[model samples]
Target: MGKRDREILKNICIESVAAEGNALAHVNGKTLFVPLCVPGDIVNVQVTHKKKNYMEGYMLELVTPSPMRLAPFCSHFGDCGGCRWQPIPYDKQLEFKQQQVVDQLTRIGKLDLPVIAPIMASENTVRYRNKLEFTFSNSRWVPFEALRQEAGAREVPPSPAPKAGHQSAPESAPLPVSGSAPATQLPALGFHVRGRFDKVLDIETCHLQEEPSNAIRLAVRDYAIDKGLSFFDLRQQTGFLRTLMIRITLTGEVMVVVVFAHDNPEAGEDDAARKALLDYLQHTFPQITSLHYIINTKRNDSLGDQEVIHYAGKPYIVETMEDLEFRIGPKSFYQ
Candidate 1:
């Protein structure tokens, strides 16, 4: 390849859809894989790798959008990172998904197999099912757009202090302050940032779950903040509220599990902390059939080994499907 051809490609026209939900385009006879793009879209990409048969690059700029592309329905698409293929039409996405299965079976498996059935696409795309987990972080994941707006000038965090509008912690609420240092970082109750586990993006409205899902999550977060409930700090592994798990069954029964760090008062913990949050939730959303809480002192937040205590209602929620009745625990797997 010539020197010009080897340079970073600009306004490269996408040729076709490629494997692994990537777009394929030939650059100087080498196939380049560009993610978060569809065919007919022209984009400027910075080449990161050069392989023998294929190359890789990240999308730098979108020059011309593909006609097949549709507007993303989710507001957190760019930063949240779960729904990368939202811009692509659902039918096109389904086509690629089906092709992916065939490609894997024929190319990778190398086995003689009969024609597979067509991929089944869900009729309802938004909030089709139940169950979602949102994490709490002391520091919210800052989006690149914020930095871009700053234009190389970053905003300095103010000296650590209680967030504005939060005056005093309830008698039962956990310690509101992280430490003596100025309370600069605010709390975030949302999904983890893409590729960065320590950071989480504060979600405003998630379309993953049905009606009360968003309502319940927002209410809990707001109530906790207003009552000066301490948000769990992953680094120090202190604070009060940690992860939130919500499950809704086919019978419309909802189960919520609120995980706290501990109940030791010396560590700024409180036994009533769980009760305060649960009482608020129960009063606000009376539809909750089963409400529970857990105390996880370890550095990790996995609840498999932790003991789940029932705060208000039944310990296990029952779900019936045909002839089988499955009782779900606080941390049970559901399809």
Candidate 2:
């Protein structure tokens, strides 16, 4: 469609949270869904997709922020696919989720139900998840906002050369010098960007999992980069570090599983590099009750059929509930 023909909505108040966490509003008789907004928000949106029953749009401007909206905790909130619904308060999130369940049961299932009680709320909003899996990619995603900010930032003078007697400090990753190119082509160890399988966001910190998780991931990334290990390219399907998985139990046991890619048949496995990385983690994080690694030769990330090798500590971590104890392996399924 032409630019002039495109529909632009103005000052529409969001009514509710719809399925899949999109902000809902009613335009005439049809439903409108806008992303990155909450109920009571007034926004101007440009419709991207239209249908007989509903419409989808991207927010042109948040004309007025919603009172129900809270400050999102994660820096990668909008771009990261790991989470959504961060703006809504936890209580309000529960309310919307509860309503979603009721709607699904009554409308879709066509079932008669008794009065539904308020959905149970989590005591802790952040760092409550038991598991998190991260991907290693050579192509790191640099946010447009960051590039723009760097472009406008004032320039600083470069440091002078050190004296002959003194050793220079270690070289860190490169930064976008002219705001045109991204920081060093260093590999990123984090979650993938929304809708982009090849782009991975370099996460500095994550609020979903507790301490030692972030530290461990960062340490491994830095170590791998320092050791000159290759990061996996999603499109090319080659690299040494492919994925990392972390699992924590209520009993304070931690499990970490690293996946290495051996896509090249001729190069064979880098056993020395793999052993060194695992050894570093073992010495660095003594609290890791379970540590494992997997050799994933496949193009995909599925580890179901792949073998999980035990490196240190126990083969599995224990999660206890009442008098029963459950062992969670590298491939075990848990809520």
TM-score of each: 0.80, 0.86
Candidate 1 residue 279 Cα shift, in angstroms, is 1.3
Best candidate (score: TM-score): 2
Q: What would the per-residue lDDT of candidate 2 be over residues 1-335, giving only the tens digit for each residue?
A: 44434576778999998877688999979999987788999977777678899988767667788998787788788777766799898888898899889999999999999998888777888888889999999877776555545555633344435344422222321121211134466578999876677788889999998878999999999999998999999999988899999999988899999999973545544887888899999999999999999999898999999999999999999998789999999999986
Tell me, by lDDT, which candidate is best.
2
Question: Measured by TM-score, how close is model 1 to the native structure?
Answer: 0.80
Evaluate model 1: give its lDDT. Answer: 0.75
The worst-scoring run of ten residues by lDDT in candidate 1 lies at 172-181
Report the error of model 2 at residue 195, Å.
2.8
Off by over 4 Å in 2: 1-6, 152-183, 263-269
